[model samples]
Target: TLENIHELALGIELAGVRFLWALRKPAGTGNDEELLPAGFEERTRLRGLVCTGWVPQVTALAHGATGAFLTHCGWGSTIESFAFGLPLVMLPFIIDTPMIARAMAKRGIGVEVARDESDGSFDRDGVAVAVRRVMVEDEGKVFATNAKKLKDLVVDEGRQEQYIHELEDHLRRNKDV
Candidate 1:
């Protein structure tokens, strides 16, 4: 997954789309910073912001300029993207990611980056293409529409109170235990 970061970084630059990347240090590296593509920051300075640690994802997503979310298909990331009505560019790494990516793609709120079958290898071109699909190309509209619908689902009227009452009823019944 660390390997893809460079390619993804390069991909974003190559695609020329505005982005906010929350980067973490790569594994097994002694360096203080992640090994991003050389000069990626300077190259993308006008259009992108790359942070090393502890980015406020919710705040970033809530901003007016924020568009699509490029994620590793983590469940929380998926929900958060949808909560903000941002279409997902799913770069699934492992485990339940593949399943969630598949579902999101099927639901028309995501576009997946292509990967090799056996080794999970993906190239920068694939990342660029997927990013463009979600951020620059016309097809992004469908994904955005479906994502907004998901936002509605999450924040729909009575949704929170219904779950709260359900939890309260269960807790009251099990208080003695």
Candidate 2:
């Protein structure tokens, strides 16, 4: 987990964009400084912030200045980002997240950071490329447009109620199966 954090720090630093990283300190680590790569704090002082405590994720996502979400593609976070019409840079690690990431990519809503085939490890370059693609590059515009479309769908109460009703009907029909 520490290794992942270190790599994330390196990657974000290399990305060289203004960032607010909500880093939960690893268990058994006493100080916040030890959780990051050496000189990372100093180097990124002007353009980056690593918060070690509770971060109000919804508030962050709602901020007008926020451009893209770098996330692990958990269902809740994914939904929240979509609700805000923020394009994503996904780095999924486990469970259904990778599948969700792939689906999102196919839908033009995000870019998944590339990982090593053997070890599934990602590096700074991959992180930078993914972030840039979703944040600054021309391709980002498409992702942004798609994200806005998704936001409309996500925030539509009528569509949500319809989905719920459909789910309930399907469950009722399949109750014995």
Judged by lDDT, which candidate is best? Answer: 2
lDDT of 2 by residue, 8-124 (tens): 889888888889999887777665447888999999999988898899999999999899999999999999999899999999999999999999999999899999999999987
Return the TM-score for candidate 1, rounded to 2 decimals: 0.88
RMSD vs true structure, all candidates: 2.7, 1.7
What candidate 2 gets wrong by more than 4 Å, as runs, is 28-33
**C-alpha lDDT of candidate 1 relative to the true structure:** 0.87
Screening candidate 1 with a backbone cut-off below 3 angstroms (N, C-alpha, C), the clashing residue pairs are none
lDDT of each residue in 77-148, candidate 1, tens digit only? 888887799999999887999999999999999799988889888888998999899988989988899999
Q: Which residue pairs overlap in candidate 2's backbone?
A: none
For candidate 1, the per-residue lDDT at 111 reads 94
Candidate 2, lDDT over the whole model: 0.93
State residue 139's C-alpha deviation in candidate 1, in Å: 0.5
Q: TM per model? A: 0.88, 0.93
Lowest lDDT 10-residue stretch of candidate 1: 25-34
Off by over 4 Å in 1: 32-34, 163-177
Q: How does residue 15 of candidate 2 score in lDDT? A: 83
